[model samples]
Target: MTNLLLLIPVAIGLGLLGLFAFVWTLRSGQYDDLDGAAERILHEDDEY
Candidate 1:
């Protein structure tokens, strides 16, 4: 039962860390160009 006390905090901390990272990425515009990246991969360049 004592182990549950320790594991609960660790799990909560990890969840919070993941949430913070996701929010940080949102604020930093990390997902702004999602469609552009996909389209870019399909684009072809004409080089001779």
Candidate 2:
């Protein structure tokens, strides 16, 4: 019973941390060029 009291808040805190990280990624444009990234690998570049 005592373990649940401590573990529940810890779990919730971890979940919120994950949600914030995901939201941060969205705000940082991490998903903006999804298709571009997939197609970019197919094209060869002239960089030496």
Most lDDT-accurate candidate: 2
C-alpha positional error of residue 30 in candidate 2 after TM-score superposition, expressed in Å: 0.5
Cα lDDT listed for each candidate: 0.96, 0.97
TM-scores for candidates 1 onward, in order? 0.85, 0.91
User: How accurate locally is residue 30 in candidate 2, as Cα lDDT from 0 to 100?
Assistant: 97
The clash count for each model shown is 0, 0
Which ranges of candidate 1 are over 4 A from the true structure?
46-48
Q: Model 2 over residues 1-48: C-alpha lDDT tens digits?
A: 999999999999999999999999999999998899889999999997
Q: Roughly what TM-score does model 2 have, to 2 decimal places?
A: 0.91
Q: How many steric clashes does model 1 contain? A: 0
- Candidate 1 clashing pairs, residues 3+ apart or interchain: none
